[model samples]
Target chain A: MGEFELIRRYFASAACAAGAEGVALGIGDDCALLAPAPGEQLAVSTDTLVAGVHFPEVCDPFLLGQRALAVSASDLAAMGATPLAFTLALTLPTADAAWLEGFARGLNRMAHNCGLALVGGDTTRGPLSMTVTVFGRVPAGQALTRAGAQVGDLLCVGGVVGEAGGALELVLGRQQVAAEIAEPLLARYWSPQPQLAFGQALRGKATAALDVSDGLLADCGHISRASGVALVIESERLPASAALETLLGAERALQQKLGAGDDYVLAFTLPPRHLAELQAQWPQMAVVGRAEAGEGVRVLDARGQDITPRQGGYLHFME
Target chain B: MGEFELIRRYFASAACAAGAEGVALGIGDDCALLAPAPGEQLAVSTDTLVAGVHFPEVCDPFLLGQRALAVSASDLAAMGATPLAFTLALTLPTADAAWLEGFARGLNRMAHNCGLALVGGDTTRGPLSMTVTVFGRVPAGQALTRAGAQVGDLLCVGGVVGEAGGALELVLGRQQVAAEIAEPLLARYWSPQPQLAFGQALRGKATAALDVSDGLLADCGHISRASGVALVIESERLPASAALETLLGAERALQQKLGAGDDYVLAFTLPPRHLAELQAQWPQMAVVGRAEAGEGVRVLDARGQDITPRQGGYLHFME
Candidate 1:
């Protein structure tokens, strides 16, 4: 099939959310049209995934497609915005019908779950890569920012962390873990679920907010640096999954959970007095630590002992 | 330098016209924020450039940076929207400070010229490539599209064509052209000037419009197929440069000129009766052809003889 037909048949048919309030016109157009609500502003972000770099060359195409969109959505989640639409720029060596079919299916599944519509993009012949740019809307001044945290704010995180890092270790055969333990961890690494709803809930409450993409310690450090405060993460309180305990043991797993990346969970700060209200809305949150009047991050054990690890977090270029 | 510093020290300084007009915030944040005019709508387009595909591997870094952003902005021009802001995703094999400096300089020059600001994007270690997504604003229902052409509308082109293609030929050493002719052509190919003002002027006037990125015949074929009409080109009327004429004699130049790509010129359909008003506004426009009652494209020389070329235009995958 030609370029236009390939786009319409595989891409334009992706499952989108029911309503079209923000999206004025969707796929199959020269450009996408969007109109934010009267009182809302637009938030935009973009990311690119390259073959053999961002993911393994032999990895599942379907999951890669889903993860590609999810990573960009994670940025919107970091901003506390409601998703509206997205555009994709896809480059491939050839027009492989089967690959396109599987990729589109994965893209549609994730897009529908996030309440986003596929708008406009381009397909070209080149080395394999995909670039997704996502849009979201939020009330003016309501979007969370990493620079808003105060020294006295409580630091918190949503859901489990470090499962994606453990999954990568298993995938690379660096560890001798069982498939049953490895399978779910691998899935988490491949398809991270961005905490969109949780992020929106922090709009007016959280002093600072960002998605934990690089790792707990590193990402939280971003908030501290931007907000000009010190972050004290309680190492013993770091959330860990059962799979992580079974594979890496509780001690090393604790470190992995703290330093591993690709966990698209919202990490935010709130006033100590509003901790009850935060828990009322989100029961899954863990009070990881607190912000202090200083610079940089410090990790403390349950006994109040400083237990900072040697490395900060994963660096893609160095790895 | 690390990713964050590389961006702040180089890429974040580009000026965006929209940022001053209530973009609210941009770059250096989790997500870029923009407040649209009360009634205006947003138009978005994305394009990716891979190393050895969209550009040569050994070209000047500054030019590559300028061209990557320019190509994406060309999409905004096609939709008859005014450029607001843009995001950049840069993937590099390693951290090359000199390359980043040159690229950012080139990108900033173009962004300043177009009044667009760099917002938020991702930077990762991977195969070398750059993806730029541009945002523009247009009044509701005033955006130009490919489906608005009527059978009797006149086909017009904004400026010179085939210079870029001829320049590429010279660059690849497929032909030995003089420096005087080669430099101008190469400049046109590497540093295209997007017709932003012209496109904005045509918003309520032109029937349909698109940038000539994929050759005249193929790009016009998009309008013909979308508008459900045949597009006939008067070959003798095609605007050709003296460099193109000198490189390939009149006959061959006409063929290459009709089927060459990367010109970044605007092609649109206008009502014949509006010629006087259009000329008064956009005197640079040159009438070259007209839409017909049938499907497909037909080319005729000065003598009314068929001048249809063998292979009509460039195909991305075939390259």
Candidate 2:
């Protein structure tokens, strides 16, 4: 069969490709038409994942599919937008039918979870990689950006961090552990649930927000630079999953929580007045830091001394 | 320097990256915010071009950048949507400053010409490839689609069809010709102008439309299938550029016009009553044939004899 037929069979027939709200037209067209509700602005983000670079070259297609969409959707969550539609540009080395089937199933499952419709995409023959461009809708002036944090706001994280970072060892076959410790970490790495609902809940409350993909200290620096305020992290307050702690012990887990990347948990700045009410609703939410009247990011140990790492997190293409 | 700095220097500082009318927030954010006109629907399309598969691996980066954006922007033209903003997910083998500089210049030039702002995108290290997701806006219910052709509507193409196809020989260094004959053909291959204005003019007039990427015959088959009608093409009506004819001669040029792809020209079905007026506005618009009450696509000779090829255009993965 032709690639066109392959795409139609694997993707066009997926459940999320069916007509959905906000999508006036979906697949099988030159362009997909989306009508955002009146007074809402469209939120758009694009992310590309390459084999070996972003994920294991030889890995489960189903997991790869899930991780790809989740990583892109996390951006919309950071913006406090309602998920609407997405386009996937997939490049594969070959047309492996079994792999495509598994991938599509996982992709559709995540699409359902994220409330995103598969509006359009292009499939081509090349290196194994995919670019997912996600679209969402937010009220005209209510999108949560990294540029709104104030000096006196408390810096917080929505969920556990560093589990995905610890899972990388098992994914690369460099380490092995019992399934009890491994499963949760791997699941966090593969199927991270973008904190969509919590981000929406933060629209009027959070001063600034972003999904953590580049470690706690590094991502907090983005908020600092964008909002023109400094961020101070209390190292003892960093949240690390039990799976991560079990896999790497407390000291290494603390290091991962501070410097490892790829955790999709949201990190945001919130005024002190709104903290109590929000914490009541979101129990996992932890206050780890605070914004300061300065520039750059700093980390503090329990002894009240600065312990910031010289280099915070991973930087792609840094020689 | 880091990848983030590379992106900021090469892309975020481009002329098109500055604040634009429709874009509320651009680069440096998790997601860009775009506000369309109140009654407009967003037209979104994504296209990926892999190195060596889509273009010569050692070709000019500047031309590659121009071709990539033009290829994606053509879909918006096909839908008669006004160009607004685009995100480019570019994966490169390395951060080659010289190549990136040239590529950015070319990309910025096309973005300016097409009136598209540089929105949010991700730059990563991987095999050389790029996926461009473009967003445009058109009045609700007025965007042209492939599902609206009537039985008697005339089949039309906006511009010259075959120069890019003929240029493939030169691109691959398989053919040698005079500079005069080669320049225009190569230009078409590297930077085929999308018929944006012509497509906008066709709004409310053309019944169905799409850009010619897959060969004319194959793309027409799409409209035929979608609209549930047969498209009959008069063989002699296929538009071949003078340069293409000069390079490949009449018969070969005709073949290229019918069977070769990557034209980026607008193909649409229009009622006869609107043809004269549209043709007057768009001098290059040519009426090639008519839709019939049937299925599939056919090509007929001037003698009215059925002469359709057994296979139409290129299909990506057909062994």
Candidate 3:
């Protein structure tokens, strides 16, 4: 198909314009034009997912598209920014019309769900890879950072974690699980909903915040190292899904939750005094642990014994 | 090395302060925050260059760094926008410290030259590739568009074309050329100067503008087909450089200039009446052709014979 036809068919849709407030020129132009809000600052992040490296080569393209955008948007969520616009650079080995349609459908579905618009990008010939650069807007002094955790703050995470990594294990044939349990696990692996609303909710209240991309323990360690405060994530308090428990078992689920990656859940640190207020308004959030007065991250079992893994989580390059 | 320390050494040098119209947050964070100018809109574009696809695998990494940023920034110039910042997604086979040093050095040098900051980026392990998403500010309704060219507008280009493609041929060992000529050609391939100033100058003057990326014939064809007007470029007046002529022979240079790609120079259309005014103010610009009442792009010889090539220029997927 011609470039014009491709832009019209796959790239132009209402779903691509959901959160594009400042986008003056969207998909039809040589470049996308966006006017940022007068008082708000823009937040930008880019991530690339390769066919075999980041996702399975034969996985659902729709789910892959959704997860790719979600992972990149999670970075924006981590900074307490509201999602706005994103550009997708799609490189393919060959142009398969059916593949394009399916991929775009998945991307559009997720784009609508997450409230982000597709702006401008390039399509090229290469091995299958998707690079999404997402933009967001946050107020001047309120963006959450990795370097803001206070010594005595409460460490929190939204919703459940470890399901995604556990799901990936099932897909890789490292574990065998029934469809009843496997469905939700696969969904978690494919469709991570970045905690946009919760992150925005924690803009001023959360001292340090980040998305749990590389597992709770590893990502929490990033905050600890950045802020020079010790963090304790209690294994007993960690949330577990029925799917995670079925596939990974209780103990293994806890281990995966502590050491696996691609959860995309929001992990934040708040002052202990604000815990009552946070819980009053948000029931989904749980104070699973606390930030202590030193450095590094610690994981404690039900009886307060150390259960921290020697290697915190996936060291991306090392893996 | 630690992830944070590696980031500090290789990525942090590319960071810049957002200044008085301050950034809510800058580098070393999950994402960077940027405040858009009061009455301005942000123009955004994304492009990815992959090893053994976009460029030769053994080509200089420093040049790859410069060319990658230049090519992506050219999209902003084409839209007549002033660049502000960029985000990079860097994927590599391994964490080659020396390679990263050179790449970052080249990127930092080009960032300084273009007056853009490295806002945020993700570094991961994969096949070597880089995806850079650039942002620029332009006044509402004033940015040049490719669909605005009217019949009879003069087609002009900012600089010489074909040098980059010519350099590629040499790099691929298909052409034997002197180093003196090859050095400049290679430099042109490695580091394309995005004609931002010239593009901005044509904001109100030119009816339509875009960078000659794929090639003059192909890119001008974009304007011609989009605007429903035929663009006729004269062979003699196609802004052939002395260096190019000396290297490729005059006839070969003319052919290369017609179909060569990656010359990140502005190609625009303006009314003939504004020609004198444009030339008086912007002497570097060469009025090489004219847009007509018909469709498609055509080249005119000394006797004004139509000399359009069978193939216009490079198409990413096809090539």
Candidate 4:
């Protein structure tokens, strides 16, 4: 089949493409039309995953599909935008029917979970890569950003970190463990659920916010640099999942929690006044750090001594 | 340099990222924020250009950059949407500073001409490819689409076609010509302008519209299928530039005019009543044919004989 036929068979007939709320027009057009509410602003982000670079060159297409959309959608969560639509630009070496079907199934499942409609996309022949561009809407002047953190704000995370990082060992066959430890970590790696609802709830509450893709210390540095304040992380308070601890032990888990990336958890700064209220609503949200009147990000040990790591986060083009 | 530093040096500090009208936030965030006018709907489209497939494996980075954005922005023109912002997902094999500098210069030039803000993007290490997702805002209910063509509506194209097709010979080193002929043809290949203003002018007048990217015959088939009508093209009336005819003789030029793609010119169906007024304003716009009660696209000769070629257009994965 041709490119158009492949897209029609796998994607256009999917459930998410069946006229979602904000999409005025979907596939089969020069452009997809989206009508956001009168006073809302659109949040847009684009992410590309290349074969052998972002994921294993030979891996499950279904999981890759889910991970691709989730990775892109997390940017919208960071902005506290309501999911609206997305466009996928897929480049593949060949048109394999089974692979496309599996990929589409996973993509549709994630689209349903995220409330994102598949509006439009382009499929071409080339080395395998997928670029997903997600769109979401947020109320005017209410979207969360990384530039609003104030001194004395408590830095928090939406959930446990480093599970995906720990899972990398299992993915590369470097570690073997019980199903209990492996399954959860694999799930975190393959199908990270963007903290969409929690991010939306952060509107008007969290001082500054972003999804943690580049490790805690490094991503916190983004908040610090953007807001012109220092972030002090209490390393002892970092949350580690039971599975991660079981697989990698305490010290390594701590290292992974601080240094490894791809967690897809929301890290934000909230005022102390609103902490109790937000914590009451989101019990899993953990306070791990605090913002101060300084510059840069610092990690503090139990003894209140500086313990920041030399390396920050994953740098894409670094050798 | 790291990926972030490379982007900062080459892209984030570029002129296009300096806060355009519709963009609330440009780079340095998880997602960029865009706010369209209150009564406008956002028009979005994504296009991917892969190295060795879309363009030559080795070519001028500046020209490649210009072509990539222009190819994507054409979708906005086809929707009759005013250019607003775009996010580029660029994957490169290495962080070559010279190539990146040239690419960024060309990208900025087109972004300025197209009135598109550089909202956000991701740069990574991989085989070179670029997926550009462009956003534009069209007045609500006025965006032209391919589903609105009516029987008896005149089929029109915004400008001449086939120059880019003729230029392919020069690009691939298959033909040699004078500088005058080569310059214009190469320019057409590298920098075909999107008919943004012309498409906007067609908003209320044109019944259906799209940019011709997949050859005239093939793209018209899309309109035919979507509008549930047959498009009859008078092959004798198909416009061919003098440069194209000079490069490749009249018969070959005619074939290119009918079969070549990548023109980026707006093709639309308009009521006959609106033609004179629209033509008065857009003198380059030409009447090529009319819509009829049937299916698929048909090309006819001056003698009223069916002369449609068996091969309609280029297919991505046909081999």
Q: Give candidate 2 misplaced runs (Cα > 4 Å).
A: A13-18, B13-18
Clashing pairs in 2: none
DockQ of 4: 0.81
Task: Give model 1's docking category.
Answer: medium
What tens-digit string does per-residue lDDT give for candidate 1 at B1-319? 4456667777866844234675877776678888888788898888888888777778889998889989888878888988888888888888887998899999999998887788777788777888888989988889888888998999999888778888888766689867888889899988999989888988888899988877898888889987898988898788858988998888767766788888888999998987788777777678989998988878888888877766667765543
- Fnat of each candidate: 0.62, 0.87, 0.69, 0.87
Give all TM-scores, in the order shown. 0.96, 0.98, 0.94, 0.98
Model 4 alpha-carbon drift over 4 Å, by segment? A13-18, B12-19
Q: Candidate 1 on A1-319: residue-level lDDT in tens?
A: 5555667778765623224878876665567788898889999988888888777777777888899999889889889999989988898888887998889988888888887788877788777888999999999989888899998898999878889888878766688777789888988887888888888888888999988877888888889988999999998787768998898888878877778777788888889987898788889898889999998899998899998887767655543
Clashes of each: 3, 0, 3, 0
Compared with the true structure, what per-residue lDDT tens digits does model 4 show for residues B184-271? 9899899989999898999899999999898899899989998999999998888768899999998888888888888898889999
Please give the lDDT score at residue A76 for candidate 4: 94
lDDT of 2 at A82: 95
**Candidate 2, A1-319: lDDT as tens digits:** 6655777788754434335888899887999999998899999999999999999999999999899999999999999999999999999999998999889988888988999988888888899999999999999999999999998999999989988889999899899999999999899999999999999999999999999988887899889999999999998898757889888999888878977788799999999999999999999999999999999999999998998888877878877
RMSD in angstroms between candidate 4 and the native structure over all alpha carbons: 1.5
**Lowest lDDT 10-residue stretch of candidate 2 chain A:** A11-20
Model 1 deviation from native, Cα RMSD in Å: 2.1
Q: Which ten residues in a row have the lowest lDDT in candidate 4 chain A?
A: A12-21
Evaluation by lDDT, superior candidate among 1 and 3: 1
DockQ for every prediction shown: 0.61, 0.82, 0.62, 0.81
DockQ value of candidate 1: 0.61
Which of candidates 2 and 3 is the stronger one according to lDDT? 2
